[model samples]
Target: MRRSIAVCTLALVTAVGCGKTEPTTPAAPASGSTSAAKPMHPAAATAMQFLQASAAGDLSKATGLLTPVAVEQLNKQGMTIAPLNVESPKFIMTRFLVTEENEAAVEFAMQFQIEGEQQEFHGCCVMKNIGADWRLAGVIIDPGNGMEPVVQNYEQELSPPTTNPANTVANPAGGQVPQTAQSPDVPQQR
Candidate 1:
């Protein structure tokens, strides 16, 4: 599980890190500024709204923007819609595109001050079509510090292996536990 999470986090970081960001410039006066901020895509906007609601601890509003599966996943994970441990959180969208016929992926970087220290983390939210609306289906955030990936929302279903452990050898040192090798294709359990 740790390896898989690391690979996924690396992939997302690479993808978002590869994008070219514009250099910041001094803002013009509101009355004189002609260029308005570009509007977010409808699906991305929904994602942003969900993030905001979640950070604000607005459970009803946050859950309203999530799929039933996501809600159930959060319940299983013992996670609640609560305020984060950071202050002045700012979100910067890195990518927003349709990933499939009825799915969209929104990649973002969240910057905030944690105990007077500035920190940033990256994550992605997947939105799926539900009739005429798009709802959050999955969310994965890497909060660094070697912490476990925060899979706060739904993704693929998880189930225990149906059979006993495979590919193990007895320890030569008379240890009771057998030594086992992990396959790259298999995700390890926490």
Candidate 2:
């Protein structure tokens, strides 16, 4: 009797398991149909595409995204315009300012490791819309130290004028001290 009960339980479990069906995956879209993907902004799309091509070591495709002036500048600098041999290349968008309806300025930072040493590079690209396509108008690469002097000069230019020699006061030693150096609240000792 016990053996018959055990066989009956085993048969019931097998029957229940066999009644279940596997889940099916959704079918892929047709080859030419990209209707499911979201579209990107023209400037951002072009810039990202250029960076991806460069990272993939496709020099021709990358250069094709640049404007004629940019290509000429690269040639003038004697640069090979090839993909940099970097490990773990990262592109970061810092700013995207639209100056006009069809013009924009894009600032980005790139970080990567070369020869095991990590480095960061900053650049700004001007993009212009030509017909329905966005293309690079110009590119400026910074060595990370180029803006210091410019900022310093601008600050100096904006600062108020320094002590004028015409407002000098004679000290005990008959030396002239600019009025700015002495506090007006304190009387000078003759």
Candidate 3:
């Protein structure tokens, strides 16, 4: 009887621990001073939410929590996808390399499977305190690979530079031009 009780108890605990949803409380309205000045232990909950969202391919909900720029960039790619047949995630965040930063960012590292392939995805999420609300700001994906974000050379994958046209070219010293139509066309230079 005691063994049966123990088995039941263990099963209950496992069920509760595995499929948990974080309570989403709408953050207070944006009042410059009253915002929660910090995010705590978000690595675990946040990671879980991400996995749930990804597994379900809930793009609309997931994108809402992400930076507009990232969404645009991905959509530009042919990867408008929500992979299926993925199993529920087993939260391994407690084993992740997590670091708490200021009120805006938290760093996390974890190993997980995607498409049955295992890879470690670690990144810094830049959160913004907007109107007493703590919404995700942006995420810089870091694989801990020490390599910069991979820039795919595919034409369909490229987005035209968002950089200001005038800012991209370097000006010569003394602000003199080599007679190229570049920057020299500006009457201000004449």
- TM-score list, all predictions: 0.60, 0.47, 0.38
lDDT of each: 0.62, 0.52, 0.40
Q: Which stretches of candidate 3 lie over 4 Å from their true place?
A: 1-52, 66-103, 114-117, 150-190
Better of 1 and 2 by lDDT: 1
lDDT per residue as tens, model 2, 146-175 = 342111111011333455534444432246
Pairwise TM-score winner, candidates 1 and 2: 1
Could you tell me the lDDT of residue 170 within candidate 3?
A: 75
The clash count for each model shown is 1, 0, 3
Candidate 1 clash pair list: 1-188
Candidate 1 lDDT over 49-81, as tens digits, reads 777766766778988888777677667867656
Clash number for model 2?
0
By lDDT, the best candidate is: 1
Model 3: how far residue 120 lies from native, Å: 1.5
lDDT of 3 by residue, 35-141 (tens): 46334344433433543455567866655554444456567775542432344433232122211222233333435578888765444334433344333433334
Q: Against the hidden true structure, what lDDT does model 3 obtain?
A: 0.40
